[model samples]
Target: MSKSNTNTRTQTRASLFTPFIAIILPVIIASAVLYRLDPLEPVHFPLDKINRSAITVPLLNKNMRLGSEKAAEGQVLGPEDLVYDAALGVVYTGCEDGWIKRITVNESVVEDWVNTGGRPLGLAFDGNGDLIVADAYKVTGFHIYV
Candidate 1:
């Protein structure tokens, strides 16, 4: 309506845009600088002589694929590693939430084996059906009594 009032409105609009530009411009400049400084390169590691083992699990039915079929027949929460005990015919998997799960492969059943109080990473079975687990926070051994 008035000249001074129009000027004040323009200044108010500029003040709102100024802070948005100030925040966005620095982020764009920093992203450009970082992109130029550290250009990503394609990494190719040749596995010429790496010794590897292949594990084959018999499917419950002929139509089920190996990886596509669920091992535990339920949702696995952050399973990091798995080990199969041939003697006991059971498979153990380490979980992130301080849990070790036991899955009977033949029966397609899963159950919580033990809680380690820390994130379990690696699992193995020692002699006499004892479960050995490696936790994330510490590298100590855990034996679970079946």
Candidate 2:
């Protein structure tokens, strides 16, 4: 091809690529600057707790023997937290099936205590034998729709 035709082709190629670069260059530069400022920055969210570092080493097991055993038997799914009640001689565990179950020491019997109607997370007991549960996705036996 001639010199003028080659120049026109080059300009045509540059024009075709210019709009893409115009749209993409700003995003690339902004992302680079944000990453440079804080590479581990979390996105803007309401309940997102960004931890600085993770504790990987096991704190309780320096030279420990790993042991496992079955604790209970029932439809008790997702026991997130367990609290022992010395008065009843039973261990109460909050489950994801919305039931706080009581199990014996020898994994013999499991009983459904109360159905919270939400997935129970944390469990605690007061001095008056009152059990406290941190139920997720529900408030006061009603599911919160957001």
Candidate 3:
């Protein structure tokens, strides 16, 4: 190839990369900013340490297991807390996707009950059978009808 043609091709390739760099740079910066912001801050709670010696209980026939397999439904991202309703037999879990999930306790089936439009932390059932959620972004309580 001629020197002029090679130089032109090099310049074109460099120019093509410029736009990609421009697009990717902002994405990287925004990701850093979002990481700093950490919208799920309220939901992230550290667990209290367990003191084994202080506890006294009768030994059971069943062995204590560490963890259980999550249901076949896609995993719940950033699950903060969970509350169970005895009457309805449903377990509500706060998730990072700005949604609260209702799962059947026996079957481990999950469904998106409601979207809070914000990250939910704690959940409780009121006397009226509505689920009250503590949201991270909003001060008002989120109510979910059963």
Candidate 4:
């Protein structure tokens, strides 16, 4: 109510807020600097540098859904190790559901191709044009399915 009392209250509020700002500003700046120095597993691989002369793998994002979209579509559980069949113009991915899914990159068409009876953990095509599937089961853990 009195002028001296109001001024004292304003000074006290300003003193409290100034210290908070001084403390928080350095913390904010230090956090930014540290993050710029070493952040999480940042995607350092540029899209252009991927799959050219040296052959960049998976950086080719055409109709590719990164991982989540295909996994959601057609029950492609735990899709792993995408092996591109360049000759066939399709990508094959092993899933945890004991199946290999063939995906047409341009069309985004997913087909349930082969079931390994065990979890298809990895997929690759051999020189003989046969798909070599590493099916991992609970007991044995490894089996080659061709």
Candidate 5:
């Protein structure tokens, strides 16, 4: 609380960041130089030749909506951003219905995963396969940890 103690605390916090900068600064500088030095030719595809296949999922052409009605059984509504779990073959999405829905891509099954009690706007899966949601009107972003 006093001036000397506050100064020491500030210095301690500044020193804590020093080691991180020291370790990362050289790597960053070296990466910038190496990135500029690397030999790589620019690629330019013809305007007419580029198709959805050029930069999309392998099965992006599949009509996922045709059978979604039967799969969802009228559960999913206003689905927002989704995260696909390749290992689980499922996609988690936030919905305007105030629930997070899990759709089993392989089986075409829809299940209400969680009730956020508010309009869920975005969805993501953490490293441990847990779902994260962004509830609307919360004044927050996708970084909501829990």
Candidate 6:
């Protein structure tokens, strides 16, 4: 109410707000300048293009439900890639636990085939019955198992 008291209050307010403005104004100005300049020049990859194809894919049946059966008992963890060997009557897959596993198509038999000591991602069989496995992280390359 008094002039001296009002002036003192106004000065205190100004003093308290000045430091915030000093810090905030520089940030606002730098943001504006960086937005204008865009020094980093961000690159966005066409992830959708890389991930999906142009062809129309069939919609999955909504009524489909997963069967209640454990394929391999604890030995196979995180199977990534699969290959079928018609001659051997088996389906082979590479697992994250650094082991190649084979399970029969009928889900009757499961076997541990190979251990790369690294994560295995993909598995394939050549004409000569050589199994090629793509191992990652520690091994970093392909290994052929005969």
Alpha-carbon runs more than 4 Å astray in model 1: 1-68, 127-129
**What does candidate 6 score on TM?**
0.48
**Lowest-sum lDDT 10-residue window in model 5:** 137-146
* Model 5 collision count: 0
73-99: candidate 3 lDDT, tens digit per residue = 566777889898998787889999987
TM-score of each: 0.48, 0.47, 0.51, 0.44, 0.44, 0.48
The order by descending lDDT is 3, 1, 6, 5, 4, 2
Model 2's C-alpha root-mean-square deviation from the true structure amounts to: 14.0
Q: Per-residue lDDT for 1-146 in model 5, tens only?
A: 79999999999999989998999999999999999999999988887775545555775766767755445546678888878888888877788877778899878788887777788887777776666677886666444333
Per-model clash counts, in order, read: 0, 0, 0, 2, 0, 0
How does candidate 3 score on lDDT?
A: 0.84
Q: Pick the candidate with the highest TM-score.
A: 3
State the lDDT of candidate 1 residue by residue for 17-131, as single tens digits: 9999999999999999999999689977777656567788886777756566567644568899988888678788988888788788888678887888899988777777777
Looking at model 6, residue 10 earns an lDDT score of 96
The TM-score of candidate 4 is: 0.44
The all-Cα superposition gives candidate 6 an RMSD in Å to the true structure of 12.8
Clashing pairs in 2: none
Off by over 4 Å in 6: 1-70, 73-75, 138-140
Model 2 poorest ten-residue lDDT run = 137-146
lDDT of 4 by residue, 26-92 (tens): 9999999998999578667886776666655796778665554433365567787788888788888
Local distance difference test, candidate 6: 0.80
Estimate, for each residue in 1-146, the C-alpha lDDT of model 2 and write its tens digit. Answer: 89999999999999989998999999999989988998575668654466556669866984565575467754568789888877767888888778888887665478887888878888777656677777886665322211
Query: What lDDT would each prediction earn against the true structure?
Result: 0.82, 0.76, 0.84, 0.76, 0.78, 0.80
Query: Which scores higher on TM-score, 4 or 6?
Result: 6
The better-scoring model by TM-score among 1 and 3 is 3
